[model samples]
Target: MKKNLLMLFTLFIALFTITSVKADDKPVKNNYRIASDSLFAPFEFQNSEKKYVGIDVDLLNAIAKTEKFNISMDFVGFQTAVDQTQAGHADGMIAGMSITDERKNVFDFSDPYFTANATIAVKKGTKNITSYKSLKDKTVGVKNGTASQEFITKNKDKYGYKVKVFDAADTMYASLGTGSIDAFMDDEPVVKYAILQGQKFETPIKPEKIGEYGFAVKKGTNPELISMFNAGLAKIKANGKYDKIVAKYMGNEASDDKKVDESTMIGIIKNNWEQLASGLGYTIALTLISFVLALIVGIIFGLFSVSPSKFLRGFTKVYVDLVRGVPLMVLAIFIFYGIPNLIESITGHTSPLNDFAAGVIALTLNASAYIAEIVRGGVNSVPTGQMEASRSLGVSYVKTMQRVILPQAVKITIPSLVNQFIISLKDTTIISAIGLIELLQTGKIIVARNFQSFKVYGLIAIIYLIVILALTIFARRLERNMK
Candidate 1:
């Protein structure tokens, strides 16, 4: 237990030292890491060639070219873009974000780049909902962290409607199609784009101007970036480039050519093989790294739980209980967003932890607690007589534990550990909330592009099933070998 604690302490210190060293390396000037929404069409979504090219993407690139500033855009989802920008992992963001007064507390905004309204959309041929009062008792959907969500939530009680929030626009649109939601509110352009793409939806109520969209950076950081964006935006609008860019995406002729026949399952698979393969790779890699770390930390804590010292056992108990009590999604968000904000508040410097590191740490913390209990149960299953016999032979307690106890405990725990690994792998889906593009998130991205929810999600499910079955077979074979 002491050695384990020492090793854990050393690991943390090493991480901190590395972070400090990197902090001293100055960031390149005028070269910014910009974050944008992955699935927000017209603003930002993939083209037919699988290249990211939307109004926001093209506009930002034009702005960068005009300003002579280098920029790299990360097409994570909207909520993730916000989180990344706030955490300083991204230098700025331009995700059709509304310039709400509330946001002014955290982000400094550029001049309004575009104007749009939020409208209530219902399925075609549904004549009932003409106003807010007409939506009484009906469920309405909104994407998370959007102006539409804020409006829906704030007026939900007054309108006597229930609200369902989705993580992405594609899912919310699907819900409306399936009647899971009677209606939904979203940006006018996005709803129109969906209609253009063959979605059977209509806007009944007059659209409300939610707010103008603006480019933003964390408050008090990168003032020059905002200045440059504003200056370049003015130039583009003056030179007629802004109107042309918007027309390219939203014009009457704007439509993606079908790269493949996505109607059939085989076609869907053929079209999306690269994305599916990449997502699966990320999922497997995250699972492998997290499980290994969890195994080490869990065994340490498990040993601590069984230690003779009351303090050690009590500390382990508290840790296991606390971590186990929190939900995985909540833990992930806290680790990714809350921790960085907390660090910045205290030390006045941004924490360098990105989504991947935060996700691994969250998964490791959650899995280790359950694994500690598994270890404790396995150790307790061994007979007390073995330890007594070893001690009677003049063996030290630590040596006896090393030579007799742990080996037997490991054998007993092997099955449970294998099961835990499988659970951890599935749990990686929850990490998508933190914006780590694991298997499920990858599916969401593809669905955002093709709107083939059934085929894409079905393919993802099959992939997961195959991987889990393989792992299960391997585990069974290992158990047979051990026997």
Candidate 2:
């Protein structure tokens, strides 16, 4: 009996020791907030489904999983992401940052998980230089303020290349395609993606080692987090998962000189745009819905602005003063991001607001303030004789305005309404801040894919110019008809 008791006590102690050891080895949950810009595709972007799904995002998730931590992401702008980390809004930035001395002073860096190779992409069926040494007097495009830009400028005498710098890689690539520039330099993946996609005019050759890309932790961030992330990255690389994800997006053979066709690319894009044309239904739908709401709100306040009663007059003035005083950007941010969060806290229901709803609400709220002024002007423009004539006929005050004053106001309001409607249409772009995909959003999506600000967004600007011009013509015709 004594021997059996000793054996049982040993078994229990051993089991408890093993369990404690396993628990201690497991990582703690992350529970950290993060932010990044919505560019850097195949790495970090808000996809069509509005989810942040990309290679960088995936790697970050893997790290969090390995480190036993949780992180929620804020899809802010890239410049904003950098600022946020510097200002301590986020703990770190994992947005395909390269460790440069200029950036290194303010931010600490993890080990380079990846290095971006440099390449010169040029138009199709063109071979000017047989060797790197043969290159001289070539006009090249490099992204502004990048190392490559500096390289091109500094070595202009050495390489004999005249460099044209642009704010975006996409525009730089597009210029290469259009022959606006002879050669372009950019990160390997971005250049390759453009080549594969239809900017086929340019192809990367010689795939030279350019710069190192790493994750950035803010200056003075927790060193333990950096160590854990570095370990997690190593594990992924060793396990073959890292290579798979890279191959899936960037292609298996980096050196394979794939040529893209012009016709096929255009056709594929046209087909996609045909589908995207249906997306305009949502755009128009929101515009019309919001226009009506704004019109109603405007007319109510407009009447109150011109009200005979002092209480009603003062109330309208206060409302006008408040909404007009607040910036549209601030209001949209508050309505879309702030209001929902407030509601969630109070009700304990994380009510998800649809992007369209938030955008429409913002547009309406903004337009109504302007519309009220337009309406008040229209109402005041009506002859006092007209109101008196209706009143003399024993009609009520409401009836006098509806039957006599408003009819005349309609003719004058027509021009103002058209202008107001145009303003509302354009202002919907601001809702992109809260994740709404309007026309500007569509342009940004294209810009992200192609990195061509000129060809991509410039084309969008042309489309807008044509659209607004057509609306102006229509408005003028309507005014003439009314006159």
Per-residue C-alpha lDDT of model 1 across residues 98-160, encoded as one tens digit per residue: 999999999999999999799999999998999999999999999888898998999989989
Span of 10 residues, lowest total lDDT, candidate 2: 254-263
Candidate 2 structure quality by residue, lDDT tens digits, 1-483:
999999999999999998875555444444666766566666675443335666788888888788777788765555546655665556677766667888889988888888877677777777785444445777888875456666567768887767788855555656766778887777777666555545565453576666787778677665555766788899999998888778756774432212222133453255336433543455667678999999999889989887778998899888788888887778876775567657856886545456578777888888888888888899999988888888888999988887788888889899889999888877766666655556666666555644445554555566667777988999999899888
Root-mean-square deviation per candidate = 12.4, 8.1
CA deviation > 4 Å runs, candidate 1: 1-30
Model 2 clash count equals 8
**Where's the lowest-lDDT run of ten residues in candidate 1?**
21-30
